[model samples]
Target: MSLASLSEAIEQDPVVTRELLHEVARRSGFTVAPRHEAAYLLGLRSSYAIAKQVDLLPDYVDPRLSIVPTLGGSRKYSKPEPDRNGLSAWCHFLNLQAVKTETRLLENRSIALKDTIAVGYIPQTLGTLPHFISSKTEYPHSQIDATVVRRLLLAGATLKGTSICENFSLSPMSYTSIFGPVHNPWQRGFNSGGSSSGSAALVALRAARKAGIKGLDDLGPDVELAIGGDQAGSIRVPAAYCGITA
Candidate 1:
């Protein structure tokens, strides 16, 4: 294939040292004959680079171009309160309203995102040891909003903040989060389910409050809706445990 004509040199694979190739061959149980090795190494210098269209994508969303703090703008956030967050469902709380450039399809509705879904400036701990073990270099605040978060704000939903989730989203149950286990909103001390644990618990807590149930307390944080991630029963199991639709 023809390569683009350019003033600057096209990229080449300069790091393919003969020693490195020997190491690779040894590890892979393959033998590269010394006679053909030089020619084989020379062949790797070809590039897959292509010419770009001036209008690469007519109106592609370049996340980096968004210089603002977030679509929700700057907003103060609160930590999980012991009394207010008995279920350990939330990672942080905020009163972030949408920027509202489109139709207000989800106006006035509060939505919580799974911690794995990045929200610009909000700490994204993913319910792990990073919650306490952090420094300026290691603190895990998200620099950009996830694609779903951007759409939710454009649709006019208020962004409440990120919710707790299983550590690295590796657990099938809510008991593995570093923030602490997420309790079932219907019955405290019981599991609120899994990797999407926080999302399910928040929604259930809101529903339980509206139902005016006697046993459920009004102490926890609530949201009208929550966005969860699913891999296996991450979302489904949590919904099932809370007796609600996810």
Candidate 2:
């Protein structure tokens, strides 16, 4: 590629450029001497040129290609809105309008998903940093859905919302998240076990409704099922704490 083209690409993505520069400087213990600055820019230009040429190599492959077929139907996804509940169990609230399917196994079943799973037009925080959230114009919409989400849609599940999780699914206590602490359903002061805390809480709330308990949240819907990740005791611990079967 021409140097001008390379510069344009870098300029278009200042966020990526900043990160790349920081990483390179950190790893190399770079210092900005006047002579060295000129040499550094020249090296970066050369590297960009080489990378541009490498893109033409036949062996290279696009990493974002997916093997799964797209789900067909006139499905509608709502824009993400905030949760009013102090439970802090949700990251984004989206109601997906259901499409009629010949096979309706999970028809009318309200489901919530962990935020780590991608949903088109929904902000995916993964219960962590804001920087992880995609820019509004990054793409037309989410290009692909997570495999589990796709399967749920195919099975005629209504995706009610995306639930919160511990930041990067690292915490067991659910306290160290960017969304703030997730509280236990049974008690306000107690912690909801994580990282599947939100999923467990949603399920527990639905279960409570079935037991004739009322007025949990005016805005909250009855979540029949929740898709959560289980590395270590993420799913099991929260499920146990919330008195729900995982």
Candidate 3:
């Protein structure tokens, strides 16, 4: 390309061009002839060019929706009221299972997903306040179910809902969610534990239920298992704190 064209491209992608050029300069301190400088530099722009439409997601995502897409979720699934969610363990509530599933191994078992996993038409709070508090114009939600979510539903597991997680699933502590802290089932006000704190908390509470343990009866509906997004000590730490396996 001409020098004028190269200059124009760098202007359009100033940040990327500058960073890449800086790195190149730092690594290769050797000097080059001025006549070949423009040609040498032109190659670097390939990484940032907008060559074509970038929508690469699957054209057709199978319907792993909230029973009905338009209505957030079916009547059977819903957001838990404040009183019902005293433990602050759930992001939302639902009873999703494949109607004509091939397997029934997990039948009657209730599971919760960490809010980070995608569940079509359900609000993906990520335990942060986007539309949940500030922006009513749009509520952050997903339009397709993650692979594991689909598999679980197909396996006849009754999905209880998405559980609240550390904000953006980053922190290794339970108190980071925007809504509130997830209380320990064994003792309220105590730590429930990490990024997957809600998931572990719910499952631990449910485990305690069958063992004849008491004190966590009304926190929310019981969950037998949870699909957590573990990055750091999200899963294991919470499990350790709650005296259960993740």
Candidate 4:
């Protein structure tokens, strides 16, 4: 749509207009004196007009190609449950129900994804600094799976859920995220090294369950595999800290 059309739509919302004006004034250091109010409004309008035009620009992609071509068929999944411990291991537990396919290589295996990786229809945060469950202004769900995720599904891995990660997958420790720190699986107050902290924790939990450890009954079934991203020591650190094989 044109700038004028967008501006007209915006002007219809009196509350929005007032809020925008207040924000503009605050950000401008309140330098817009009464004598310059008209000029300030005009400038704000022009800026908004330009922003609207920019927003309308189409995002072009080659229609002839796909990032990862789908396999002959799609695999089904079961709904995933959140971690019981305050490990903050998961961002969102997905609900996908599917029967196992016997012919696939990874048939019956369950997998948890790091939040940095995209999963179709699930929400991804990559551990945003100031995290919110959803964004009002953006598309609500991921439209496609990451290539790794798609490959896993094709090989018959069941996507159980998405795990938490360091903010933007940059931190070496898990403490600096909106979901809070991922605790060491063995020690409650100890740090779980990031940004693959959750993945390691989940694996450790699964191992604990397999070992018939008491007091870990709430951790659900054993996860056969976990997918995590690494830069520096994200994957290895957490794995060592949690006493699990990465």
lDDT of 1 by residue, 1-246 (tens): 233442122344445567867787889999889898877565443321222323353665576434234344575778877887878898889776655436688888899999988777777887777635366534487667677877777777888878889988888788999888999888889988889999999999989888886766745668889999998878888989888896
- Please provide, for model 3 over 1-246, each residue's C-alpha lDDT reduced to its tens digit, 9 standing for 90 to 100: 555765576557565554566577768995546676666556656444433112433466555533322222352457789888878898889877776666898888899999988877677778887864346654566767788877887778888898989887778878999878998887789998889988988988777777887766667686888988766788988999999975
Is candidate 1 or 3 superior in TM-score?
A: 1
Per-model CA lDDT versus the true structure: 0.76, 0.71, 0.76, 0.67
Put the candidates in lDDT order, highest first.
Answer: 1, 3, 2, 4
C-alpha RMSD in Å of predicted model 3 compared with the true structure: 5.5
TM-score of 1: 0.78
- Answer with 2 or 4, whichever has the higher lDDT: 2
Q: By summed lDDT, which 10 consecutive residues of candidate 2 come out lowest?
A: 61-70
What TM-score goes with each of the models?
0.78, 0.64, 0.76, 0.62
Q: Could you give the candidate ranking by TM-score, starting with the highest?
A: 1, 3, 2, 4
lDDT of 2 by residue, 126-192 (tens): 6766656544533234545666776777678878888888988988887877878887766666877
- Candidate 4 lDDT, tens digit per residue, 1-246? 765776675555344364567687799787556677656666666666666677888875443222333333443333344545455676666433333333487776888888878676556777774335454643245556667776676677766787878877888887876678877656567887888878888788777667776776665443667888877988988888888888
- Candidate 4 achieves a global lDDT of 0.67
